[model samples]
Target: MTEKNPSQKTVSSRQNIRKWLLIISFLLIPVTIFYISPIVAMMGAGKGIVTSAILLYILLFVVSLVVARLWCGWLCPMGAWQEICSPIFKHTVADGWRNWIKYGVTVLLFAMLAFTFISAGGIHAVDPFFGTVNGISITSFQILMIVVIIFLIIFAAAFFTGRRGFCHVLCPIAGLMVAGRKIRNLIGWPALQLDTAAGHCIDCKKCSNECPMGLDVNGMVRQGDMENADCILCASCADACPKGAITYGWKKK
Candidate 1:
């Protein structure tokens, strides 16, 4: 056999590394949000974790721009929850309901964003994870705990039964993040794309099955479409690809 292209192999290895790191991050986000630091320390200066300062949200935007939703894919606790569900539930129409929930959540996030701009508390109130983690009231804490339990159960059930259920259907945060990325598609950072020519996909449907957001990764690749802006970029699709068709790139556009 001819010598392996070292650079190509290196890139593939890096892609695999990022994929696994995203999974690790998924496990870490919730712990960090709840226990470590409600808001992760940014590369730049910042004071309060969740302040009314537009700068904080702006900082989030910059982070998203730089990482291109990799945070959602790898480090979001909620995403991890869904990814856990993927192995539990086989792909089904039930997942369709969960996937559609994002539309309603998308509206909700925009509504909160607008209200927060006016009332200041709107965004904070609707962020379920944030509310659950940092609530001051005992009743609120109980509610958050219940919500967390419900999501956990959903994840566990989905895990045993089939594929992702909660994240694809009920996760408001995933919906919000996807909507934000769609509104600003050019992430201006490194990203992974499914390349058609690689034909690496064996059409095993693992990517679709593994997707916490419940996207049709194989179909999207075959159609030459990457319109599913909600993609977590978890690299589950890339990981499952047998032919190595899915590749990482700074920008496919």
Candidate 2:
């Protein structure tokens, strides 16, 4: 086997760091569940909706307006889980009209939240650790079951559909991020984005193949349209490209 070059080693080290960071974040999900749980956010302590998840999502959306879904790429436990299972199903999910499903789900979830709040006469209290037991997620058998079922569905979706299938088709949080990204784009704000130099591309499809989100990175590079709402900003394409055709940069201009 040929010895790896220094640049390859550097890229490999960065990829490993990103992977381990995601794994560590995913491992801490049980503790951070209270802050990210949709159920707990939607249904409060038998009174009104919990404010933690809502506040967390709001913060995420604000971040997305500037960074464009970095939360999904770097910190989301569900994204980490799907990536861990990518070896089992490395197929690219077909992106078409089907991608609209997540938006519909987001709308439905918002509608439900609104109805719940209205029924309860608006949010009455704020409990960051609403469903959690002493700030831990899996305290009781019931909570454990709920967590198990959620993971089961996530796993099933990734196993059958493709890489980050649930994120593409089902995650309401993704829809929210997309909305934030769209608003940023419309306003032409300086935001985190993938910058590509199509002239440097050597037709190597490694970037596209290595993309965890299964985006057509090669095509995007060729078209000089590197900004996609679906892009999670993982920078896998940048690392995988040998020619340094792709890069992560802010769209400041």
Best by TM-score: 2
Tens digit per residue, CA lDDT, model 1, 72-148: 67665555566544544556434345467656864675464454445432233222233233532123555457547
lDDT tens digits, residues 55-170, model 2? 88888889888888888888889899988888887788887966788899888887888888888887788877777778887777777788879988998887777888888888
Candidate 2's C-alpha runs over 4 A off are 1-11
Instruction: For each candidate, give its TM-score against the true structure.
Output: 0.60, 0.93
TM-score of 2: 0.93
- Give residue 244's lDDT in candidate 2 (0 to 100): 80
Among these predicted structures, which one has the highest lDDT?
A: 2
In model 1, which runs have C-alpha deviations exceeding 4 angstroms?
1-31, 34-61, 65-68, 92-98, 109-150, 153-162, 184-192, 198-214
